[model samples]
Target: MSLVVTPLELPERWDEPGPRGDAFRAFHAHAERSNAMRFGPDVVARSPEERLASLQPSLAEACRAFVAHRDGQLVGALKVYTPLLESTDVAEIVISAEPDLPDAEVLDLVEELTTHGEQVAAGLGRGDFRGGSLAAASGAVTAATGFGGVDPDHPEVAPLVARGYVLEQVYRISMVDLAALPDLDERLAAARAGAPGYDVVAWAGETPAPHRAGMCRLKEQMAADAPGGGVLFEPEVWDDARLADFEASAASGGRTIRTVAAVEGATGELVGFTSAFVGTSTVVNQQDTVVAGAHRGHGLGALMKLANLAELREHHPNHTRVVTWNAEENRPMLAVNEATGFVTVVHDGVWKRRSVS
Candidate 1:
């Protein structure tokens, strides 16, 4: 049977009251499930209603969806977001009828989207389509189109390499598993015994305000620690107001953001930190985990992680899994994961394609 792909009608179909709503909801549910299995539970814990509502505006304005139909049955779909951003060309989310579909079909779908993306960019007078997190199967399209690999340590890129995509840069995805929470008292006692004169604290919502400045400094430090000289894509700086906004976003999505910080007793300087959030639907996602350069050898990373894990176990006991990612080459962060018992699950790759005109 022949396959046909076409653009999805927006607001009209998306906001409608009946069959369209059912289809849209089903599609989003499918997308969420795929994301959970492919990217892990932390990344996607939204209900179909929540996802559709959150994505409606973007999908209505700058987003496009392509549906692949084989024998009149919808087999695959891809959603691309084209916000007028500085660095990324397109942000994408995908779902497929055949989760284990052959690599060739996945490549074909990606190529088709790339072609569509190029035309969209040209129409807007932009000359490139910069995308990230190309799955293993889709890496073929990315490679074929000259999308340079970036961040080899990126959690998604290894599978792409196995399928022949080139390695570019290494970025780490740091994670902790709630299922394996260690004894907090023993972990903290060990860290304090080893480091001496260091204290750790957990904060959220308004409580994070006191440490906003310290967190912002850590945010700036991230660029230096990032492999490939990581770029801060968002405009908002890490400050009290921004932290509040993040907390709000998490709360609205039914998630809790827990930020843990390690501070020196004498100097009161922030040395290490980690953030974890539990979704309303019972998934825990780790955000950023960092330790200042001066305090590296003291095992503060593991301490901060253990503190966060303890808080999650006590406060959000319903959470089933704790999910996070790190660049493949980030040994230090990976060391913390090893100490905390986070097993490697999924590997993904980042791909880029520039316009040839």
Candidate 2:
């Protein structure tokens, strides 16, 4: 098969009439196909407008896209993201191809896309290229955290391994049936009674100006405290401007960010927070949940999640499920999620390859 790879020239608008518009639609289609193959046919995919809006660069990262074609038809797409806030040495690459193709053809596309990814990373002065793929937990290759494994024969895994990428970590991807949640009212009451001097507050979209800095600090702390296993994730730098950029970008993509945070009653500072990103689909993505080290063990994590779920149900009644990813070793967060109604569906492997200097 003669496959041609070309950089995708992003159009100024999603509805623009041209070859770029066609490529944009094809890129989203490839992603949807890949998602269905990896997660199942029921997976909710980003709409074309949402996908285009998501490509907008933010203060944290900039993305570049590429497309692969065979016989003038798109067969694969690649996205490379370079972090601007922190972890500047790393480039995150996501590549996917048509699922109907044979393994050999799939690997060929993978190889070609990975080479393009590496070249992009080199041009950006990045030394580490990182990628992740979702797979069943029962497999021969175990994660560093000892909780999940990926079958070596999995299409996504084989290509990365063949390309010399080491499995750094595995994240448990869980789905929460909002309707089937464990007596959250009881759980919330118990969690609140167990913890004193903290009040849980919920908000949608932009963060209140007073809590913005606290939210930034909490985000930075989350980046520092989260389990990394072998993946070298640097502590992210977050400020008011960066936070605004995040909210703006999400709003542009038609995503509503619902946040539930625990505030110190005396100091009026945010101590822990949980966020849910809701799009037009029925699925809501649980983005981040973290508690400050000093405030740990007070049941703030569960309280925030319970409050967030309440907010989600009250405001976004159309959404039926919530999905989240947690490091296999993140027992605290995992426990909170499991107790709330989340069950593991699959495990995602984080693979990294460092350039040889």
Candidate 3:
């Protein structure tokens, strides 16, 4: 069958629901299924409306998405995004294929998509870009630099290596079963004894006006504090405007973000925090957890994580598991996760290439 490649016509059918837009829904379903394979379903969990919102242009990233069709069926998709935050010289691309596609056809489609991605990157004043493709293992997404070389194990790694990409980072994927979660009472108590000056604060949805300023600062701390593992990164700066934009986007996508934070009783400042997101999906996704440097050794990180997880479980008892990813070098956070019942399920690699376009 001949394959046709074109820009995804979002406005033409994205809003059509149910019987009215079978084609649009078909593409969306394909994307969701493909994402479930690349990242765990819980990690990429999103309704079609939420997924659609993600594909739309954002102030932080302008995306150009494309789909490949064969025999009137959507077989593959490629999304290229140029970050407005940092890495102006770089772009990020995600490519996926229908599970049943022949290897040759998948390669052809990906090659075409990569070519298009490079064009977009060039238009954005970037000399090179990165692309992430599903590797051979489950829950393993491999990234390549310069639109090419990536994790050695991914099926597409060879092509990328030939194109000058090389492995840069490995991130371990971990999961915790909520049913078997051990008692955190002992840990929480010990942590609280040492951090008696700090109290836990819990919230659902947007932060309260009183805590908004502190939450913003804590988010920035999370970015600055997390281990980068050698990829180009710019610390994401956050403020009321950005946080509101984030909440609005999450709402539009049918998501609820729940957070737990440790506040300094004396200053009313958020010193550490953890976030978990649940939407229409059964699996909860653990996002950022960070403690300000000044509050590090006091066990506030573990306290914040434990408090949030308990609060989350109480509200969403049906959520079977929680999933999170950590860079291999982030031993402290990994230790906290391991102690809390998280087990490594898969490993993902991030790769980089330069001036390949």
Candidate 4:
């Protein structure tokens, strides 16, 4: 059967009862199945309602989605996120298909999705493209960063390689069971004591007024300081407006934001911070954790993380596990995570296509 590709008509409310709502739900279900096949059975995809709630757009980025059908059955999807910040020249695209399809069918679906995604991006004046996917670590195709590799034979990976996308970096997806860590309190105490010059502070929901500017600065620094390997990303620009938009968007999506920060005791400035998203599901996502360049070596990263995990426990007690991704080359952050009970579950390959111009 011939494949039909079309732009997904996003609903004003994802729950509106109609053909659009049905398509929305089916697309998410297909996404979940694709993730399970690409990663492993242990990996969990976001629930449809949870995914819909979090589909937020902001001044910094605009999001779009497309669905593929064959014989009126939803078979594949493509999403594009165009950055409106300093990296406006590039956009990120994600494409997925229903699992267990024949190899030929899968390739055709992926190829069409890629061609469509590029056309949409180019129309928006985006020349560079970024994407990520999970792949088994069994092939000779190594990331340029020299830290991780992915099987080129993997169904999800081969199409990208064939289309000239280069593997830039590999991210290790780690998970930690909240209930399994019996010594969290002790670890928090040690991390706090080690950072004598810094004090820990935390909050649930929106950023407090006094810390908004400082948080913005830390966010900007996070984009600049985090290890990107060969991926091209200009530092993000965050201001009061952007922060407010972020909080509102998260709230609209039914996600509660929990944050912990390290304050320099002498200056009372927020030099480092970490945040987690507690959504409608049981999983807690460990978001950005960064310490300013001058504030490194004080164990601030670990300190903030431990404090945030404690906050998650106290406020959102029903969480099953904390999940985070880090560049495989980032040994310091990985060390902190492993010591705190996180184990590597899978690896994600970050791929990029240089400007087509």
Best candidate according to TM-score: 2
lDDT of each: 0.59, 0.84, 0.73, 0.82
Q: Give RMSD to native, each candidate.
A: 5.9, 1.6, 3.9, 1.8
Residue 296 in candidate 2, Cα distance off native in Å: 1.0
Better of 1 and 3 by lDDT: 3
lDDT (tens digit, per residue) of candidate 2 on 299-322: 888888887877877898888788
Global lDDT of model 1: 0.59
Superposed by TM-score, candidate 1 places the C-alpha of residue 99 at a distance from the truth, in angstroms, of 1.4
How does model 3 fare in lDDT?
A: 0.73
Backbone clash pairs for candidate 3 read 50-253, 145-352, 145-353, 146-353, 148-160, 149-160, 149-165
> Candidate 2 versus the native: TM-score?
0.95
Candidate 4 residue lDDT tens string, 1-357: 888887777666767799888778777788778877865543455766667755557767788888899998888899999988778888788888888788778778777788788889999999898876674343488888888899887666788889999999999888888899888899999998898888999988899998999999999998988899888588788889999987777666567888898889999998988989887567788889999889987888888888888888888888868889898888888988887888888888889997658
TM-score of each: 0.74, 0.95, 0.87, 0.94
Best by lDDT: 2
Identify the superior model by lDDT, candidate 1 or candidate 4: 4
Rank the models by TM-score, top first. Answer: 2, 4, 3, 1
